[model samples]
Target: MTESTGGIDMDEDSSGTVKKFAFINRKAPYGTVYALESLEVVLISAAFDQDVSLMFIDDGVYQIKKGQGTKGIGMKNFSPTYRALEGYDIEKLYVEKESLEERGLTEADLLVDVEVLSRADMAALMEEQDVILSF
Candidate 1:
Protein backbone atom coordinates (compact mmCIF):
# COMPACT_ATOMS: atom_id res chain seq x y z
CA MET A 1 0.00 0.00 0.00
CA THR A 2 1.11 3.53 -0.73
CA GLU A 3 -0.24 6.69 0.84
CA SER A 4 1.13 10.18 1.40
CA THR A 5 0.05 13.44 2.99
CA GLY A 6 -0.76 14.66 -0.53
CA GLY A 7 -4.11 12.78 -0.41
CA ILE A 8 -3.94 10.03 -3.01
CA ASP A 9 -3.51 6.40 -2.06
CA MET A 10 -2.63 3.23 -3.96
CA ASP A 11 -2.81 -0.18 -2.35
CA GLU A 12 -1.19 -3.48 -3.32
CA ASP A 13 -4.41 -4.54 -5.01
CA SER A 14 -3.47 -2.06 -7.73
CA SER A 15 -0.07 -3.60 -8.36
CA GLY A 16 1.80 -0.49 -7.23
CA THR A 17 1.29 0.99 -10.67
CA VAL A 18 2.27 4.59 -10.18
CA LYS A 19 3.76 5.78 -13.46
CA LYS A 20 6.10 8.68 -14.12
CA PHE A 21 4.49 11.37 -16.24
CA ALA A 22 6.57 13.99 -17.98
CA PHE A 23 4.62 16.79 -19.64
CA ILE A 24 6.56 18.78 -22.20
CA ASN A 25 5.05 22.21 -22.82
CA ARG A 26 6.35 23.77 -26.01
CA LYS A 27 3.66 26.30 -26.87
CA ALA A 28 3.25 29.91 -25.94
CA PRO A 29 0.46 30.80 -23.50
CA TYR A 30 -2.78 32.54 -24.58
CA GLY A 31 -2.52 31.81 -28.29
CA THR A 32 -4.43 28.54 -28.34
CA VAL A 33 -5.56 26.03 -25.69
CA TYR A 34 -2.39 23.97 -25.41
CA ALA A 35 -0.83 25.57 -22.38
CA LEU A 36 -4.00 25.62 -20.27
CA GLU A 37 -4.96 22.10 -21.26
CA SER A 38 -1.53 20.81 -20.40
CA LEU A 39 -1.75 22.36 -16.95
CA GLU A 40 -5.13 20.78 -16.40
CA VAL A 41 -3.82 17.37 -17.33
CA VAL A 42 -0.89 17.74 -14.97
CA LEU A 43 -3.18 18.59 -12.07
CA ILE A 44 -5.49 15.71 -12.81
CA SER A 45 -2.60 13.27 -13.06
CA ALA A 46 -1.12 14.48 -9.82
CA ALA A 47 -4.45 14.18 -8.05
CA PHE A 48 -4.73 10.61 -9.26
CA ASP A 49 -1.52 9.77 -7.41
CA GLN A 50 0.75 9.56 -10.45
CA ASP A 51 4.31 10.83 -10.38
CA VAL A 52 4.30 13.99 -12.51
CA SER A 53 6.91 16.26 -13.95
CA LEU A 54 6.47 19.35 -16.12
CA MET A 55 8.98 20.80 -18.59
CA PHE A 56 8.88 24.09 -20.43
CA ILE A 57 10.71 24.32 -23.73
CA ASP A 58 10.49 26.47 -26.86
CA ASP A 59 7.89 29.25 -26.44
CA GLY A 60 6.31 27.20 -23.69
CA VAL A 61 8.73 28.94 -21.38
CA TYR A 62 6.48 31.99 -21.62
CA GLN A 63 3.64 30.24 -19.91
CA ILE A 64 5.32 30.63 -16.56
CA LYS A 65 6.75 34.11 -17.05
CA LYS A 66 6.01 36.34 -14.08
CA GLY A 67 4.00 39.56 -14.25
CA GLN A 68 1.76 38.38 -17.07
CA GLY A 69 -1.18 40.65 -17.87
CA THR A 70 -3.97 39.36 -20.07
CA LYS A 71 -6.14 42.46 -19.92
CA GLY A 72 -4.40 43.88 -22.99
CA ILE A 73 -5.38 40.75 -24.92
CA GLY A 74 -8.92 40.38 -23.56
CA MET A 75 -8.15 37.14 -21.77
CA LYS A 76 -7.99 35.97 -18.17
CA ASN A 77 -4.50 35.05 -17.03
CA PHE A 78 -3.90 31.59 -15.64
CA SER A 79 -0.17 31.84 -15.01
CA PRO A 80 -0.64 32.07 -11.28
CA THR A 81 -1.78 28.46 -11.13
CA TYR A 82 1.78 27.30 -11.72
CA ARG A 83 2.61 28.35 -8.20
CA ALA A 84 0.12 25.87 -6.79
CA LEU A 85 1.64 22.71 -8.20
CA GLU A 86 3.47 21.92 -5.01
CA GLY A 87 0.21 21.88 -3.09
CA TYR A 88 -0.80 19.01 -5.33
CA ASP A 89 2.44 17.17 -4.62
CA ILE A 90 3.75 17.81 -8.12
CA GLU A 91 7.00 19.71 -7.78
CA LYS A 92 9.23 18.60 -10.61
CA LEU A 93 9.49 21.42 -13.11
CA TYR A 94 12.20 21.65 -15.74
CA VAL A 95 13.16 24.37 -18.18
CA GLU A 96 15.41 24.06 -21.18
CA LYS A 97 18.50 26.24 -20.75
CA GLU A 98 18.94 26.66 -24.49
CA SER A 99 15.36 27.67 -25.04
CA LEU A 100 15.51 30.39 -22.40
CA GLU A 101 18.74 31.80 -23.81
CA GLU A 102 17.42 31.74 -27.36
CA ARG A 103 14.56 33.94 -26.27
CA GLY A 104 16.63 36.39 -24.25
CA LEU A 105 15.25 35.01 -20.99
CA THR A 106 16.91 34.02 -17.74
CA GLU A 107 15.76 31.70 -14.99
CA ALA A 108 14.61 34.76 -13.08
CA ASP A 109 12.03 35.38 -15.82
CA LEU A 110 10.00 32.37 -14.71
CA LEU A 111 7.33 32.45 -12.00
CA VAL A 112 8.09 29.04 -10.53
CA ASP A 113 11.24 27.32 -9.38
CA VAL A 114 12.51 24.99 -12.10
CA GLU A 115 15.63 23.02 -12.77
CA VAL A 116 17.41 24.41 -15.80
CA LEU A 117 18.75 21.58 -17.93
CA SER A 118 20.85 21.45 -21.06
CA ARG A 119 19.42 19.71 -24.10
CA ALA A 120 21.42 16.57 -23.40
CA ASP A 121 20.30 16.44 -19.80
CA MET A 122 16.69 17.11 -20.77
CA ALA A 123 16.84 14.19 -23.20
CA ALA A 124 18.08 11.97 -20.40
CA LEU A 125 15.09 13.06 -18.29
CA MET A 126 12.69 12.19 -21.07
CA GLU A 127 14.17 8.75 -21.18
CA GLU A 128 13.38 8.27 -17.49
CA GLN A 129 9.61 8.72 -17.78
CA ASP A 130 7.09 5.97 -18.38
CA VAL A 131 4.91 8.46 -20.29
CA ILE A 132 5.85 11.63 -22.14
CA LEU A 133 3.22 14.20 -23.07
CA SER A 134 3.82 17.28 -25.19
CA PHE A 135 1.68 20.39 -25.24
Candidate 2:
Protein backbone atom coordinates (compact mmCIF):
# COMPACT_ATOMS: atom_id res chain seq x y z
CA MET A 1 0.00 0.00 0.00
CA THR A 2 1.67 3.20 -1.14
CA GLU A 3 0.33 6.69 -0.77
CA SER A 4 1.58 10.03 -1.92
CA THR A 5 1.66 13.00 0.40
CA GLY A 6 3.08 16.39 -0.48
CA GLY A 7 5.17 14.83 -3.20
CA ILE A 8 6.62 12.21 -0.91
CA ASP A 9 5.77 8.55 -1.12
CA MET A 10 4.44 6.84 1.97
CA ASP A 11 4.27 3.08 2.25
CA GLU A 12 1.67 2.00 4.79
CA ASP A 13 3.16 -1.47 5.10
CA SER A 14 6.61 -0.07 5.72
CA SER A 15 5.54 2.98 7.66
CA GLY A 16 8.80 3.46 9.46
CA THR A 17 11.13 2.28 6.75
CA VAL A 18 13.87 4.75 5.97
CA LYS A 19 14.84 4.99 2.34
CA LYS A 20 18.42 5.70 1.39
CA PHE A 21 18.40 8.61 -1.02
CA ALA A 22 21.45 9.67 -2.93
CA PHE A 23 21.57 13.09 -4.61
CA ILE A 24 24.17 13.03 -7.37
CA ASN A 25 25.26 16.55 -8.28
CA ARG A 26 27.28 16.87 -11.47
CA LYS A 27 27.13 20.49 -12.56
CA ALA A 28 28.92 23.63 -11.58
CA PRO A 29 27.04 25.60 -8.92
CA TYR A 30 26.77 29.13 -10.20
CA GLY A 31 25.77 29.02 -13.85
CA THR A 32 22.95 26.50 -13.53
CA VAL A 33 20.02 25.65 -11.25
CA TYR A 34 21.06 22.05 -10.67
CA ALA A 35 23.13 22.69 -7.55
CA LEU A 36 20.46 24.72 -5.78
CA GLU A 37 17.71 22.35 -6.81
CA SER A 38 19.66 19.36 -5.60
CA LEU A 39 20.32 21.06 -2.27
CA GLU A 40 16.65 21.82 -1.78
CA VAL A 41 15.68 18.23 -2.56
CA VAL A 42 18.24 16.90 -0.13
CA LEU A 43 16.82 19.09 2.62
CA ILE A 44 13.28 17.98 1.80
CA SER A 45 14.21 14.29 1.98
CA ALA A 46 16.04 14.86 5.24
CA ALA A 47 12.97 16.57 6.70
CA PHE A 48 11.01 13.42 5.92
CA ASP A 49 13.46 11.43 8.06
CA GLN A 50 14.86 9.74 4.99
CA ASP A 51 18.49 8.69 4.93
CA VAL A 52 19.96 11.20 2.54
CA SER A 53 23.46 11.36 1.16
CA LEU A 54 25.01 13.69 -1.39
CA MET A 55 27.73 12.89 -3.88
CA PHE A 56 29.42 15.69 -5.81
CA ILE A 57 31.19 14.52 -8.90
CA ASP A 58 32.65 16.13 -12.02
CA ASP A 59 32.27 19.91 -11.86
CA GLY A 60 29.86 19.52 -8.98
CA VAL A 61 32.87 19.50 -6.69
CA TYR A 62 32.93 23.25 -7.18
CA GLN A 63 29.63 23.48 -5.35
CA ILE A 64 31.43 23.16 -2.04
CA LYS A 65 34.69 24.75 -2.91
CA LYS A 66 35.83 27.28 -0.34
CA GLY A 67 35.74 31.04 -0.88
CA GLN A 68 33.35 31.09 -3.78
CA GLY A 69 33.04 34.59 -5.19
CA THR A 70 29.61 35.10 -6.66
CA LYS A 71 29.72 38.88 -6.47
CA GLY A 72 30.98 39.13 -10.02
CA ILE A 73 28.25 36.78 -11.21
CA GLY A 74 25.44 38.60 -9.36
CA MET A 75 24.34 35.36 -7.68
CA LYS A 76 24.09 34.56 -4.03
CA ASN A 77 26.68 32.08 -2.91
CA PHE A 78 24.93 28.97 -1.65
CA SER A 79 27.99 27.13 -0.49
CA PRO A 80 27.28 27.88 3.16
CA THR A 81 24.17 25.74 3.01
CA TYR A 82 26.34 22.65 2.80
CA ARG A 83 27.75 23.38 6.24
CA ALA A 84 24.27 23.57 7.73
CA LEU A 85 23.39 20.08 6.54
CA GLU A 86 24.85 18.64 9.70
CA GLY A 87 22.09 20.28 11.70
CA TYR A 88 19.54 18.46 9.58
CA ASP A 89 21.29 15.11 10.09
CA ILE A 90 22.36 15.03 6.45
CA GLU A 91 26.02 14.49 7.06
CA LYS A 92 26.84 11.81 4.54
CA LEU A 93 28.48 13.97 1.88
CA TYR A 94 30.96 12.49 -0.58
CA VAL A 95 33.14 13.87 -3.34
CA GLU A 96 34.87 12.09 -6.19
CA LYS A 97 38.63 12.11 -5.72
CA GLU A 98 39.42 12.11 -9.39
CA SER A 99 37.17 15.07 -9.96
CA LEU A 100 38.88 17.04 -7.26
CA GLU A 101 42.32 16.17 -8.59
CA GLU A 102 41.42 17.09 -12.13
CA ARG A 103 40.20 20.43 -10.91
CA GLY A 104 43.37 20.97 -8.86
CA LEU A 105 41.50 21.00 -5.59
CA THR A 106 42.07 19.16 -2.36
CA GLU A 107 39.92 18.36 0.67
CA ALA A 108 41.15 21.53 2.33
CA ASP A 109 39.75 23.56 -0.53
CA LEU A 110 36.19 22.59 0.26
CA LEU A 111 34.02 24.60 2.61
CA VAL A 112 32.66 21.51 4.33
CA ASP A 113 34.12 18.22 5.45
CA VAL A 114 33.34 15.31 3.13
CA GLU A 115 34.52 11.81 2.42
CA VAL A 116 36.55 11.74 -0.77
CA LEU A 117 35.97 8.56 -2.70
CA SER A 118 37.58 7.02 -5.75
CA ARG A 119 35.46 6.47 -8.83
CA ALA A 120 35.13 2.78 -7.97
CA ASP A 121 34.08 3.53 -4.43
CA MET A 122 31.61 6.13 -5.63
CA ALA A 123 29.96 3.54 -7.89
CA ALA A 124 29.71 1.12 -4.97
CA LEU A 125 28.09 3.77 -2.83
CA MET A 126 25.53 4.55 -5.52
CA GLU A 127 24.58 0.88 -5.71
CA GLU A 128 23.59 0.99 -2.05
CA GLN A 129 21.07 3.78 -2.48
CA ASP A 130 17.38 2.89 -2.57
CA VAL A 131 16.72 5.99 -4.65
CA ILE A 132 19.27 7.86 -6.69
CA LEU A 133 18.42 11.34 -7.90
CA SER A 134 20.88 12.90 -10.30
CA PHE A 135 21.05 16.62 -10.91
Candidate 3:
Protein backbone atom coordinates (compact mmCIF):
# COMPACT_ATOMS: atom_id res chain seq x y z
CA MET A 1 0.00 0.00 0.00
CA THR A 2 2.02 2.94 -1.34
CA GLU A 3 0.75 6.49 -0.97
CA SER A 4 1.37 8.99 -3.83
CA THR A 5 1.68 12.80 -3.42
CA GLY A 6 -0.77 14.65 -5.66
CA GLY A 7 0.85 18.12 -5.53
CA ILE A 8 3.36 19.38 -8.07
CA ASP A 9 6.56 20.95 -6.74
CA MET A 10 6.41 24.59 -7.82
CA ASP A 11 9.21 25.87 -5.66
CA GLU A 12 11.83 24.65 -8.12
CA ASP A 13 10.91 27.33 -10.62
CA SER A 14 10.26 30.11 -8.14
CA SER A 15 12.34 33.24 -8.46
CA GLY A 16 13.33 33.33 -4.84
CA THR A 17 11.16 35.55 -2.60
CA VAL A 18 9.76 39.04 -2.78
CA LYS A 19 12.48 41.52 -1.91
CA LYS A 20 12.72 43.67 1.18
CA PHE A 21 12.64 47.31 0.18
CA ALA A 22 14.16 50.47 1.52
CA PHE A 23 12.73 53.84 0.59
CA ILE A 24 15.08 56.79 0.61
CA ASN A 25 13.36 60.15 0.89
CA ARG A 26 15.60 63.06 -0.10
CA LYS A 27 13.13 65.91 -0.34
CA ALA A 28 11.05 68.00 1.98
CA PRO A 29 7.42 67.05 2.56
CA TYR A 30 5.78 70.38 1.81
CA GLY A 31 6.36 72.64 -1.19
CA THR A 32 6.73 69.51 -3.28
CA VAL A 33 4.92 66.27 -4.09
CA TYR A 34 7.73 63.79 -3.48
CA ALA A 35 7.14 63.38 0.22
CA LEU A 36 3.42 62.68 -0.13
CA GLU A 37 4.01 60.29 -2.97
CA SER A 38 6.61 58.39 -0.95
CA LEU A 39 4.20 58.10 1.95
CA GLU A 40 1.55 56.65 -0.32
CA VAL A 41 4.00 54.07 -1.64
CA VAL A 42 4.95 53.08 1.89
CA LEU A 43 1.30 52.46 2.76
CA ILE A 44 0.78 50.42 -0.37
CA SER A 45 3.83 48.29 0.37
CA ALA A 46 2.62 47.65 3.89
CA ALA A 47 -0.76 46.60 2.55
CA PHE A 48 0.90 43.96 0.44
CA ASP A 49 2.84 42.63 3.45
CA GLN A 50 6.13 43.70 1.98
CA ASP A 51 9.11 44.22 4.25
CA VAL A 52 9.64 47.96 3.96
CA SER A 53 11.74 50.66 5.57
CA LEU A 54 12.04 54.42 5.25
CA MET A 55 15.14 56.60 5.38
CA PHE A 56 15.08 60.38 5.47
CA ILE A 57 18.07 62.19 4.07
CA ASP A 58 18.99 65.70 3.07
CA ASP A 59 15.93 67.95 3.31
CA GLY A 60 13.64 65.00 3.71
CA VAL A 61 14.26 64.85 7.45
CA TYR A 62 12.24 68.02 7.75
CA GLN A 63 9.13 66.14 6.74
CA ILE A 64 8.89 64.55 10.14
CA LYS A 65 9.63 67.66 12.18
CA LYS A 66 7.21 68.36 14.97
CA GLY A 67 5.07 71.50 15.19
CA GLN A 68 4.88 72.05 11.50
CA GLY A 69 2.41 74.88 10.76
CA THR A 70 1.20 74.91 7.20
CA LYS A 71 -2.23 76.36 7.84
CA GLY A 72 -1.03 79.84 7.01
CA ILE A 73 -0.37 78.66 3.48
CA GLY A 74 -3.77 77.01 3.27
CA MET A 75 -2.09 73.64 3.48
CA LYS A 76 -2.53 71.28 6.36
CA ASN A 77 0.60 69.93 7.93
CA PHE A 78 0.77 66.22 7.26
CA SER A 79 3.54 65.47 9.72
CA PRO A 80 1.15 63.65 11.97
CA THR A 81 0.55 61.05 9.30
CA TYR A 82 3.93 59.51 10.06
CA ARG A 83 2.72 58.61 13.51
CA ALA A 84 0.19 56.32 11.87
CA LEU A 85 2.87 54.23 10.20
CA GLU A 86 3.35 52.11 13.29
CA GLY A 87 -0.16 50.72 13.00
CA TYR A 88 0.73 49.44 9.55
CA ASP A 89 3.80 47.58 10.86
CA ILE A 90 6.13 49.84 8.96
CA GLU A 91 8.27 50.96 11.86
CA LYS A 92 11.81 50.89 10.46
CA LEU A 93 12.25 54.61 10.05
CA TYR A 94 15.80 55.94 9.70
CA VAL A 95 17.26 59.43 9.75
CA GLU A 96 20.73 60.28 8.59
CA LYS A 97 22.82 61.55 11.47
CA GLU A 98 24.78 64.00 9.35
CA SER A 99 21.68 65.38 7.74
CA LEU A 100 20.06 66.06 11.09
CA GLU A 101 23.21 67.67 12.44
CA GLU A 102 23.60 69.79 9.34
CA ARG A 103 20.09 71.05 9.84
CA GLY A 104 20.66 71.56 13.56
CA LEU A 105 17.84 69.23 14.48
CA THR A 106 17.77 66.70 17.28
CA GLU A 107 15.64 63.59 17.37
CA ALA A 108 13.41 65.43 19.83
CA ASP A 109 12.46 67.81 17.04
CA LEU A 110 11.18 65.00 14.90
CA LEU A 111 7.51 64.08 14.90
CA VAL A 112 8.38 60.41 15.35
CA ASP A 113 11.19 58.34 16.79
CA VAL A 114 13.70 57.00 14.28
CA GLU A 115 16.95 55.10 14.15
CA VAL A 116 19.76 57.52 13.50
CA LEU A 117 22.56 56.20 11.32
CA SER A 118 25.74 57.68 10.02
CA ARG A 119 26.19 58.02 6.27
CA ALA A 120 28.52 55.03 6.14
CA ASP A 121 26.16 52.86 8.12
CA MET A 122 23.28 53.95 5.97
CA ALA A 123 25.17 53.05 2.83
CA ALA A 124 25.93 49.60 4.20
CA LEU A 125 22.37 49.08 5.31
CA MET A 126 21.02 50.11 1.94
CA GLU A 127 23.28 47.60 0.25
CA GLU A 128 21.62 44.80 2.19
CA GLN A 129 18.18 45.67 0.89
CA ASP A 130 16.96 43.88 -2.20
CA VAL A 131 15.26 46.97 -3.56
CA ILE A 132 15.75 50.66 -3.01
CA LEU A 133 13.32 53.40 -3.99
CA SER A 134 14.35 57.01 -3.79
CA PHE A 135 12.10 60.06 -3.72
- Candidate 3 lDDT over 2-106, as tens digits, reads 111123233757344555778889998777999998898888878766678899999999999998888788886778889999999999999999999999999
Off by over 4 Å in 3: 1-18
> Where does candidate 1 have its weakest 10-residue lDDT segment?
1-10
lDDT-wise, the better of 1 and 2 is: 2
Off by over 4 Å in 2: 1-9
On lDDT, the candidate that comes out on top is: 2
Which is the leading candidate under TM-score? Answer: 2
Model 3 scores worst on lDDT over the 10 consecutive residues at 1-10
How do all the candidates rank in terms of TM-score, highest first?
A: 2, 1, 3
**TM-scores, one per candidate:** 0.87, 0.90, 0.86
**How much does each candidate deviate from the true structure in C-alpha RMSD?**
6.2, 3.7, 9.9
**Superposition TM-score, candidate 3 onto the true structure:** 0.86
Clashes of each: 0, 0, 0
